[model samples]
Target chain A: MQRIAVIDYGMGNLRSVSKAIECVADNAEVLVTSDAKLISTADRIVCPGQGAAADCMAALNDANLINTVQELIGTRPFLGICMGLQVLLTHSEENDGIDCMNVVPGQVKRFASPLLDTSGQRLKVPHMGWSPVAHSVAHPLWDNIADKARFYFAHSYYCAPDDQGSVVGQCEYGIEFAVAIAGQQLFACQFHPEKSAKDGLQLLRNFVAWNGKS
Target chain B: MGLAKRIIPCLDVDAGRVVKGVKFLDIRDAGDPVSVARGYNTAGADEITFLDITASSDNRDTMYHVVEQVASEVFIPLTVGGGIRAVSDVRRLLNAGADKVSINTAAVHNPELVQEASDKVGSQCIVVAIDSKCVSSPGEEPRWEIFTHGGRKPTGIDTIEWAVKMAEFGAGELLLTSMDRDGTKIGFDIGVTKAVSDAVEIPVIASGGVGELQHLVDGVNQGGADAVLAASIFHFGEYSIGEAKAFMQQQGIEVRL
Candidate 1:
């Protein structure tokens, strides 16, 4: 059976992500592990995270998985979710400016305070709930998913890729921010596909079927 | 387009079984939590909230099992509330596949629990549930106070102040319920809902007394709530989540339909 390893760095819950992938990938052996050997051997790597950026980076270093993650990013089909996407960037402004993996050349920014919509209503921080994500490029992950499809979101910071071309999906709260980013053999999102119902499930199905081509 | 206002269907679970009671009384069996959640997921609910009304520790395990089963198949954001007193409880629910855990009475008694839990598990997963009731008299400046023990005991904390403090304490969201209109079905207490929503930077979910679809719209447009939650109207099949979303959309409020 094909093997998919979900990197576990002792951050948030990995069950939902693994369970969601399991629900769709019938033939893949979905393993949640921090074992470097296991991850190196997997067909796909999914890195999911929650909580503070500094803490997440610290955890990655403490678990000795930073090198493992750096090695696996472009070698195989890799997917990142939420803080997982943030930590891949150059650096984050959260926790008084924390350095990240620098795998993706971008800065993570916090949503400006007192953010307002067109109607002059103050948009809440954390930007919680479902928002429509507009695709910026045609890729395999966007297959079967509609343009501007709503996905679940829960975060205060967003990714701002230095190379705008890396952005594959954009979502607007107070400002239009990059919610999905992609490169050769890799795709990541700021929202949790595992928790986002139907369209989310379709995205996972696409990820499973993808063969690391653009 | 921007963030769409959320429509959440709340299921009150007691000892692993889904139950609905009017004003916390006249209890009746609704159905199994997992099946009901699955049905809501198909009907286009933005998220699901399971409030465990079970009072004993022995019965709490059932809530965990119910959350796990529902979360495994439903695939939407699931929030489990009630009887969450410590950081461990939050971890337990998150381990069970719940996306978030709402803290109510425990938050009021030991406000530090909110900070500790948020610090331990990201603030994104910490939700502080507030049950507030109007304390103002007619023809007076509107005021409200937090209530505990199912809105029977007042905690003397000002509603707006508590909301701001919770946000400062790292609460990612607030589930604000109006005790005065909880079971009345007249509508939400737009005054208090708006008060708390405007006072806090985090998203607030306006709950209680949603008798019709228009009430859901009012919760967003008028109350300024990022999300609206209701029980009876959905539990008894009065209006489907899709219909509610359609009505809200007609009223020019963005929804996930």
Candidate 2:
């Protein structure tokens, strides 16, 4: 059984993500932990975050989990969600802008579109709800995840990775935004796969199964 | 892009557990809110709306505790209503981990409360909860009227008008429930939703009528709701959040998928 360590840095949504992982990988040992040792020893990792982007990074820094995460990427299976994904960027526009994990070479910015609808309104800020995610090619992380899965989203800022190829899934809310990305064994999604239901569970299963094979 | 439809799961949380019934009566199928929220969150829920079903004001502590508990547990953005009346209440909930607070009875009595709460918190943090009943009276076209105090007292304010006014006062979101459709599992009040969504610039969540995935799709496509909040179907495990999102995507609406 693949050991999936759900990195918990006193952040939000640890339990649901664990439950989702459990639903998919019943044999997999899904444990939520902030300890660097457990993260280092785990076969794979799932990082879920809520609240401000900077706060999430701060939590990691406070807990000293950043180095462990850095060491795992490209070697061990790793997934980041929402703030978890945002913190992987160079920096975000959230909360006076804190430096990110620097794992991905990019800056997360706010929506710049101003085009309005027939009612003279463009998309609102904090693009909430389920938006469509499009991708050019399949990423291994998306394994059982469908081509156009309507994953849950609640975000105000978006990651603008310097390397465009990293983005594997895209969602359009008045404007297109990166929904999912893959950089070697490191997979991240702005949408909440833990809360995304069967497709989400399937994605978790794929990560575990992929980890097992890898 | 057209207005996106949202599939929301309603949670009537009490002591950290989810309690549901028809028209707010005959409660059955009580489940843990944390577990149920996990179910909806994984199922592709657009957003989760939690209503404190506990009637006693004394449960404020427990309600606050539950809100903090769920917020700590779930990562998705959530809206919390019920048992919230003052700016302090709003402050406590937001501080405790809720992204938005829904106001109903308080706003009905003191329309200024909307502005007050919005001023203290950002307009984006306040949501106006309107429980409306369809009234077809002589010399008046058929329209939904706002009700307050757990849907018992009629405020006589037009539902659409109330939504618009609340927005003007800094209430950024509207959680509009149709008293006639709630708990019936029929569907949402598309007409009311369209009227309110057309009337306000802020996002409007269509609640009350949600029987199945089709209802959620209709609420977004035809109804013009930014999101759809339902309790029975998803809470009871009848329809999963992923099925509802896929259903919405199939209808040509943009969803996370």
Candidate 3:
């Protein structure tokens, strides 16, 4: 059976993410671990994170999994959720402009204060709740999930990828931003598929069966 | 805007079993928190809020188990509140798999617990639940007052002012409940809901007095709440989350449906 390792750096909601993957990957052995060896050998790696970018990076470094993650990126199927997606960017405006892994050539920018939608209504920061994601490129992970399907997002900062070709999905919250990106064996999303209900589970199931291909 | 407003089902659990009551009185069994949570997930609930109505020390363990069970079963964000007194309490629940922890009476008493809990565990996981009731003094313009102890005791603090203070204290979201309209089912106390939602920039979830689907619409359109939370209606199966979302969508409100 293919082993999927959910990298845990003592950040974010790891159990729910692992449980969601377990529910869908009936044939895979899903393990939530911070051990670099376990993560390095897994057939697929799922990196999930929440909270501040600086803190997430600090925790990842503290766990000594930073290099392990960058090494596994192209070797196996890798999925990132929320901060998982942000940390891959070059830098984040959060924590006063902290540096992140340069796996994806982009910078994370915070939404301007007092942000308003086109309707002139004030948009809430953190961008909590469900929002539609537009597909930018076809990939295996998008299978069984309809276009414009709503996904649960809870974050203030968003990614601005330098390579638009790598962007696979887009969402808007006061402004348009990339919500999902697909490159080589890497597929990450700004929304939490575990918290996104039925279509979300479908996405995870797709990831499990993807085989790290385009 | 771009984000869809949320329709959340609240599961008030006691001794690991779901319970429901009006204005925190005449409690009755609803179902198992885990199973009910699963039902809500399948019904297309935007999110689920599992509150341990009875927060006794003994029940704390029960609540933890319930949260763990529900979180494993359902794939939506889970907000667990009640009896959360300290940062350690918040950590315990989060470790048990809750996405957010809602603080009520404890936050009212210390106030700083809001800041501490938010800072210690990140603000996004901290939701301050304010139970407010309208107070009408003779010849004076009636104003809503903050109430603690499940709306049984009055805090005498101005509801709007307290809400603003909580937000300043690092509360990511405000779960605003109206004591007067809680069980009346007339609808959310729009006056208080608008008062709090407008006062703070953080997302506000309007709770209490949701009798039907229209109430949910009124919560977002009239009260301007970022999300709407109801317990009895969902617990008794009077309105599925789908029905509520469909009705809200028809009313021109953006919902998960």
Q: Which candidate is the best by DockQ?
A: 1
User: Pick by lDDT: which candidate is best?
Assistant: 1
What digit string (tens of lDDT, one per residue) describes model 2 on residues A3-85?
A: 88999886565666776677678788888898888888888888987666766777889999888888788878888888789
DockQ of each: 0.79, 0.14, 0.69
Per-residue CA lDDT of model 1 for A6-90, tens digit only, reads 9999887688899899999999999999899999999999999988898899999998999999988899999999999999999
Model 3 has an lDDT value of 0.88
Higher-DockQ candidate of 1 and 2: 1
Q: Which one is best on TM-score?
A: 1
Checking candidate 1 for backbone clashes, the offending pairs are none
Error of 2 at A175 (Å): 2.2
Instruction: Give lDDT tens digits, candidate 2, residues B2-75.
Output: 33466667777775566663222223334666666655555556567888877666665887777666665565
Q: What lDDT does candidate 1 reach at residue B167?
A: 95
Worst 10 residues of 1 chain A by lDDT: A114-123
State how far residue A70 of model 2 sits from its true place (Å): 3.2
Model 1 DockQ reads 0.79
All models: lDDT? 0.91, 0.74, 0.88
What is the docking quality class of candidate 3? medium
In terms of lDDT, which candidate is stronger, 1 or 3?
1
